[model samples]
Target: MVAHEADYEYVIHKFETEYYTYDPEDDSEVKPGPNTPDINPKDVKKLPSSFIPEVKNECAQIFYRFKCPGSGLFHCILTGLVFDMTREAELLYKIIQWDESVLQPAGKMAAGPLFDIKCCEDAVRQLHFPHCVKTQEALLSDGLLSVAHFTDDAMSFIKPLKITDTHVIVDNPHLSAFGLVLDFLMGIWNKQVKGQVLLFLSPPNHAKQTQNINVLLLPRNIPMTEVSKHHQPSHFILVPSACNLIKNTTYTVHCPVANKIQPKRAEFDMEFGPNYSPTFVIRLPMNTDEVTLTIRDQTDTEVWEHEADLTDHLPFSADGRIPAEKIMVMLLDILEDLNDEEFKKFKWHLKTEVWNNISPIKENYLSKADRNDTVDLMVQTYEITGAVQVMENILKTICRNDLVKKLSTLRH
Candidate 1:
């Protein structure tokens, strides 16, 4: 065993098949140290017969020694006994912990697929490590049983997650859709561990500018030290559903490590692939913020009904003032009481008195019963507020008190 020093930098190397990937980012031959011996496959050896019992009993402290070409330093990792070897080289084998400011020395070991070691920080910052003593090796070894199926087989031996309790509170309809699946996953996870797993899923809300799944997993009864040795809270983007535009449509839940392991923060993606799980689809309308939404299926049956915004497509001010064209619709409804000659006389008075501008309403549109043309002209020529003021003046001149009241109520 070597003592760790604060001034020394530690480097971890991945062991590749061709050659131990001394430096994955670099691919050059490493020169040997002054007293270092040659490394060859023929010269590789195993642990002594005396240590066989320790290895078998899972009491052996295993260390992987390799040359680091990047910093020209020898690296030694204290990989705990009973590690998965199939994908060992790809794992982030360096284990350390933050002691407020600097990363304190923790045993270097490989956590299997079921386990993870991460740095937990509210904001992204570079992890600072205390100096440690560096150790190197000259020779290589073999005969360590490269077992790979340890974690997966162990987890598979237990029963999967299930929902048995009926007292679970499910208030949100969208969450209710995912109740069974969450119960299943939570059950399976809770069985392996002592704590209860809570998955909080917040779907995208266009009005709120939430365009992705914001899922958070909180482990009840689990210690912070245990959690710090595993995953950190992160934004897990999921595959969005194909019917995304339609409101209340349940999108399938797709996340990283969906099959191998449970994710602390998982994204429910909508992309199509082998990893796709057709999860629950909520029952609601496509446009959530609208005042009313009606969807009729091919059978003429209503599939969805929700409130929709009536003025969403209208050309009106943000404060609800209707444009001249919309005002014309209301005016026509009121003026239907006038006879054709009387309507003509009213238009002549409007053009000559109220609206004395060079560009006036055409005679034919006003003389005829259809005032669409005159309304369209007014919309283009005047602001809704100005047009309504002129309309109030015109109504007063004609002694149309009833029409004035109607316009007042319908103007906005």
Candidate 2:
């Protein structure tokens, strides 16, 4: 984001004190006198919780504790008011301290601390209203810091990462998916880096509250082993992971990925010439329908295209022989499984294997007449019969009509 020339920097000081400790309205450490006005900690609460004393002699830190009448929404440890109050924010932390025993005492009502917004950046505005409406405005910073806060049900995927409510995570389960992701991140110098990408649970978290699709993301600070429990089902929520991923729902996986970087020299060396080494074609198994492919070089351009499909010329293993493309694909999978030594050896073996697989199958290669005859038989015999069968089923079930009637309707 570019800043305009006339943009001015102004500082405004306001006081807030929560009626409940952690309250928003009555943040003022200094109490209002009879002549002064009352802070709005939700008119529901008669007054703000008595202020908590500041940490003694701690000029650097001024603390006020507040309690709203009901559950409070003041999530920021220190909302925009407190955050912008300083320049170099030493440290920011939120501690969710709740006592299970001290429970609401099973009586009238109980309250617990949800979040703490400690430091607000210089570019933020907290607008406090008359009756107690809370809204926040964050000013854009060059490359300082970014924070994204989300609701609780969606918290599991993110909690371990301990990302501030301000940061967002981008995850692509199928990175092998076309070189889409790499091309995207490479296209723009976005400040947002891949922190701990969380596989979410519902739509905005697994894909929303109603659907059932499990998206596993590695939890921050957790080992890959523990990831089993941490893999929350991400909601139907679709935010592009391919830097170029624009529309969340549509699949834009086309550019192939770096399958097996060809040795500076390898025989049948498809990667060097064919200009179409499924090896260089970064492909990912993105769901059942979409396949994302990331091209390593400038095969296309600097950025990955947002929409790509590879269904027609899909490089699956052909008739009895392994397609060079399929060989590249399998090598990619094994590449993940094999160690460095084994992989190098297997690659060398791949050339030998391809030759062996190809030599034996060469005799079986079909002539164009044979291929055309089979295709014609399939279309004429099977395809047309399939259409007739479908019509017969519809007549028997929906209309109970005879073939003669159905044929007349079609002809008409």
**Winner by lDDT:** 1
Per-residue lDDT of candidate 2, residues 220-330 (tens digit): 221111222222222211222222211111221232342222222111110101011211212133332333333222223332322222221111111211122222233
Q: How many clashing pairs does model 2 include?
A: 77
lDDT of 1 by residue, 207-295 (tens): 64432222222222122222221222211111110111121222222232122122222322211111112122222222333222233
Candidate 1, residue 12: how far the Cα is off, in Å: 82
Kindly report the root-mean-square deviation of model 1 from the true structure over all alpha carbons: 31.7
> What C-alpha lDDT do the candidate models reach, one value each?
0.26, 0.22
Model 1 alpha-carbon miss at residue 369, Å: 7.0
Off by over 4 Å in 2: 1-88, 106-211, 214-236, 239-412
- The most accurate candidate by TM-score is 1
Per-candidate TM-score against the hidden true structure: 0.21, 0.18
